[model samples]
Every structure is written in C-alpha cells, then in structure tokens.
Target: MIGVGKMKQYTNVLDKPLTKGKQEVSLSAFAFLFSELVQYNQTQVDNIGELERRLEDAGYAVGARVLELLCHRDKGNRRETRLLGILSFVHSTVWKVLFGKVADSLEKGTEHEDEYMISEKELLVNRFISIPKDMGTFNCGAFVAGIVRGVLDGAGFPAVVTAHFVPVEGQQRPRTTILIKFAEEVLHREARLG
Candidate 1:
C-alpha cells in the first residue's frame, strides 16, 4: 500500500499529465497588454535601462518561484551538479516549465568555456514588439534573460544572463539569444569534477 505522500505524488502526476497540449492565446491581447505595461513603466522609470531592469527583476522573481515548483515536481528526489547537466536541465526542463516548449538551441561558447547561449527565433513576449524610432532602446526580451538567471541561480549555477537580438539568414523575426556567463568558481568546480 502506498503512503499518503506517495499517493499524493502519484495523483499529482496522473492528474496533470506531462503531455498537456498547448493552448492558443490571442496575440493582440498580449500585445496590447504588454504595450500598456511598457507605457506605465515609462513614467516611473528614469531611463530605458531602468525599465528593462524592472522587467528583468520581475522575471527573476517568477523564475525563482517556477524553479522551486519544477524541482519539487520533477527532481524532488535528486539535485543537479554538473554544468552540461544543468544546461540540459535548463534547455529542456526549465524551458518547458516556463514557455511550454524547449528552447530552439543551446550552445557553449567556443572562445570562452564559461559561457553558454540559448537562442530562440520567436520569443513569446517579443512577438509583437515593434520599437519606434523614439523608443529604439527598448527590448522587452530582458525579462526572458532575467528568468534564465533565476533558473540558473536556483539550480546552483550562479551566472550572468543577458538577452540580445541577433539576425540570422532567412529568418524574418530577430533571433533572441541569451548569453549566460558562469562565474570563475563554477568553472573551477566543473574542472575538479571532470
């Protein structure tokens, strides 16, 4: 007979099947809402960077909470340690938990071993982001970067995460790439483990 905790775990897994289909949402609704949010922040923030930072910080809070929930649900019995292992966890587990799909690509920096990159062509939040000439400095993708930072830090791989738009051939929408640079201590630990 299963204990109460074991029963609850089984019920949770069964009740919420991992293969839940993606739900369609109105892009216009999201865009209008996001535009208003940006406008509202504009008055309170001193500059564009500060507004981006606020969005990033909001994402960081979401990421921290999401990470805790994900770990509890999927990896409750185990913890991640290695760099590549954690990277995979982020690309797959964290991505699915947050965006409902795994990232398009995850690459390690060739020149710098401590850096990793997650690239996605169509970022969800940036789907309808069209910065006018006056607001050329704004890129809402900083929120995504913040979420990545939260996931990495929660998994014990403290790092710096930044989001940027990199154009690729044959792609209309800009490719949003998240560059993650692990601190020196993380690299040293990885070396010791290897």
Candidate 2:
C-alpha cells in the first residue's frame, strides 16, 4: 500500500502547465467510463435518487476544478462578479469547453424571480444513457447540474441545480433543461450590488 507521505510527494497535475493545442478525448472512451460509473453507483444504491446523488457528488469536485481552469483559460483567471456575467460564462465558455459547442439557450424563469435555465439539445454526458421506465423521472443530466452547482458554489453564489428532460418536437436528441435556483442570500446580494 502507498504511504500517505509517498502519496503527498506526487506533483499536483492541475498545477502543471497545459500544452497549447487541441487535446480531445474519444467519445467512446468517455461513454464507456461513464457507463461503468453509473453501473458502479447503481450497485451501491437501492433507489434512483441515491444513485443520482452519488453521481452528482462525484461530479461536484470535477466542476469546482473545471471552473477554476475555465476562468484561467477564458478570463485571465478573473472571476465574474455579476450574476448575468457568470451565467453567460457558463453558457458559453463552460459549455464550449465541456461539449465543444455552446448551450442552445439561456432563459430566466418567468414565474420565479431567481431562477435561470440552460437548455441543451443533447448534453454529451447523456448521449448514451437510457433510463428505464421504472426509473421514473431519473435524468443522467443531474450530474451536469451538480457540476453547475459546484461551479456556482465555488464562485460564492450558492444555488440548487436540477436537470429535467424536455423533448423538442423537431430535435433528434431530447432537450435537457438545467434549472438553477439561486439562494435568497445570493439574490439579495445581487440586488444590492446591481
């Protein structure tokens, strides 16, 4: 077994410089890995909610780190201070980095004062996922929502993020709607600072 001291001696890969050029991962490799992730999580949980929670928890850490890297790559390591600015950053930069394309749209909720939606025709993460009918409303996009939540929380904007499947009439791939509900304190702060 590796000792704690020995483990600590390894260099942090995040601190290493990224090579300048296109570095793309194969979709098949990602899909296989993700499918294994789901299968492993499913064995540990008795219900869909628990499985989703496990997946989300796994994605959260990745999201936090991705936010830092994305900010470094796109904004010269500067964090967005405004609500809309952060949303726009996620919609464009984050989407591009993760999916090689931007999200289809970003829209504010009409009924709620502090809700925002990011819609995607086909989220890469859910490209090969097929939820059975018995799974009820289970959506693999919850992992992405958790990533969004982690990014927001790391940026000092706490929010609850959830994913819903909404199929479009003409779209081949079903739409994924990531709902972001900001905390009361965040809204109050935004109002005061806006």
Candidate 3:
C-alpha cells in the first residue's frame, strides 16, 4: 500500500503541472489509452449498452474524485448554493479543469429555474469516434454526462445529467448538450437562502 506521504507527493506532482491556466497535452496519448480501456471493458460487458454504461460509470467515479481534488485545490471553497451560480461554476471551472476549455454555451431552463444546460461544441472523446453501421446506437457522450452528474452530486447539487446530440449549423462535429436537472429541494433551499 502507498503511504500518505507518497500519495501526497504524487498528488503534488500532478497538481503542480496543471495549476497553470492551461497546458497542452497529446490527444493521441489519451485517445490510445482510452481506446484500450474501452476494449478491455468490452471484454467484460455482455452487450454494447452494458459497455457504454460501464464507461459512464467509470467516468462518474472520475468525476467524483476530480470534484474533490478541484475543490481542495481551490482552498476548499464552499459549494455553490444557487442553481445558476453552480451551473456557471461548472461551466467555467469544472469544464476547464476537465477539458481545458469552457463550455460553448450555458442556458437556463425556461420551464424551471433550477434546470440548466451546458453545451459543448466538440466533446473530446467524440471527436474521433465514428460509429460503425453495427454500432449505430453507441455514443460516448454518456460518459461526459456521468462525469457532470458525479461532479454535481459530489458537490451537493444532486442533479440529473443527460447527454444529447444537437447538430448545429456549420459545425463538423456533433455538438453535445448536457442537461443538468437540479432537485427541487435544492432550489427551495436556495430560494430560502436568498
């Protein structure tokens, strides 16, 4: 087992490099590893849906851990108490931390004040994924949605995150919009706080 000091050292090494505004990374390196991970998981899954679910679950775990680390890096700032505030924080901070860029758009739900949407022009994983005829239903966007869900839930938001493909004009890649539906209790609490 790794000792606490060793773990801290490793964390320090990882944190030191990324503390800067943004860092360039090799997409091919990440993509190759991700492909291998998917292939390995595919062996354990019985069907395509199961594989995708497993990938999403894995992303969720990553999100939970990432949320903690990010908050800790920010000196343990208290989680956002309002829906819009948290959504903005997620789009700006969380998106940058995870994807090196802020989301393309963030919109409020017209039907409900608690609901919000984060849309990305080109999700990293989907950039190179070409769905074959046999795997027409496969979409890696679920993994990203799971990440958002995990991050929000870990930060006490308890929201439902769903990924959808929204084709935009003049965009080569499919735009992914992640809809985050906050719990009513959260909104009520925020209202009370206000």
Candidate 4:
C-alpha cells in the first residue's frame, strides 16, 4: 500500500548511482533559488556581517551532508586522513561534484602557516546576484565558506572559513576567495601525524 503524500518507489534516491558532476538543475533555476536563500537570510539580520554568518551557517548544513554523501558513495567509505589530501579532495572532487568543475586554484597562505585559500574567478553565488554599493562587504560567497567549514569540520578538521573578493589586474569583476584558517588542534594533529 502506498501513502498519499509520499513518493512511489522509483529506484529510491539512495539506491541510484551518483553522477559525475554532469547532472544539473537549470542554471537559472539554481540562481533563483540561491537568490531566494540570500533574501530570506537578509530579512533575518541587522547587518552585513550577521547576514554573511547566517548564510554560512546555512551552507554548513549542506557541506556536512555533502561530506557524508561523498564519504559513503564516492570514496567507498574512505575519508582523507591528511591535511593536503583533504584540501585537494575539496578543491577537486567536492567542487566538481557541486559545481560541475574543480575550483580555479587552491593555495597556501604566504604570511601564515594556518591559512589556505580557494579562489574562483566567479563563484556560483556571486555569479548571478550583484551586491549594491550600500551593502558593503556583503559577500553571498559566505555560504560557500560555510559549506567548506562544514565539510572540514565534519571530516574532523575544524577551521574558520570566510569569503572575500580580490581585485584582478585587468578584470572587471573581482574573484572570490574562500580563506580557511585551521584551528590550533588541527595543526597539532597534523604535526603529530607527520
């Protein structure tokens, strides 16, 4: 017997095979949904920083789920155990699965041992919605930063993650950079593991 509200069995989503970043929702549809997410969060906060935080928190939930799914389905229950390995997994596998492409670049910070940066020429959130001048420093990419944080934290590598726009030499729209600063315990663990 089938329930009225529930979906009829059709291979069950969990039983279906995962796609190789090829399956996608329409870009316009995704943009519209993301825009709605930002707007809903906007109504909940008093300032730009708070808004970003809320967006990040929302993203963290997604990131956590992504980590779990990838761990079980894609990697065959194997999780990366090294710092660089995890970062590379995020930059390549995770990004590909989420956005249909790998991140543009991943780099270690020049001035700090605890920092790394993942940069994209045009981040998905930043691609469609343009920020007005009044909303200074309000980056929708904060959600993606949250996603990164969630993925890292779920993988036992907690860190502070943030998104910023950096100017290019000749480009009009600045690139978005997700900066990750590892927690003290993560660094200590890395050293001990080494």
Q: lDDT per residue, candidate 3, 1-194, as tens digits?
A: 22433433445555563354334567887888778877898899898878878877888998898787777776465666566777777898888877888999999878987778888888887777776778765777778888888888887888877777777888766688888888888888888988
State the RMSD for candidate 4. 4.5
lDDT of 4 at 126: 79
Worst 10 residues of 3 by lDDT: 1-10
lDDT of 2 by residue, 1-194 (tens): 22434333328876656433454567998999989988898899998888888888887887898898877776787999889999998898887887888899999999999999999888898888888888988988888998898889889899989999988897665689999999999999999997
- Whole-structure CA lDDT of model 3: 0.78
lDDT, candidates in the order shown: 0.80, 0.85, 0.78, 0.90
Using lDDT, rank the candidates from best to worst.
Answer: 4, 2, 1, 3
Superior by lDDT: candidate 2 or candidate 3: 2
User: Where does candidate 1 stray beyond 4 Å?
Assistant: 1-33
Can you give the TM-score per candidate against the true fold?
A: 0.80, 0.89, 0.80, 0.91
- Pick the winner on TM-score between candidates 2 and 3: 2
Candidate 3: regions farther than 4 A off: 1-23, 75-77, 111-114
Candidate achieving the largest lDDT: 4
Candidate 2, residue 32: lDDT: 95
TM-score, structure 2 vs. true: 0.89
Find the 10 residues in a row with the least total lDDT in model 2. 1-10
The candidate with the higher lDDT, 2 or 4, is: 4
lDDT of model 4, residue 182: 96
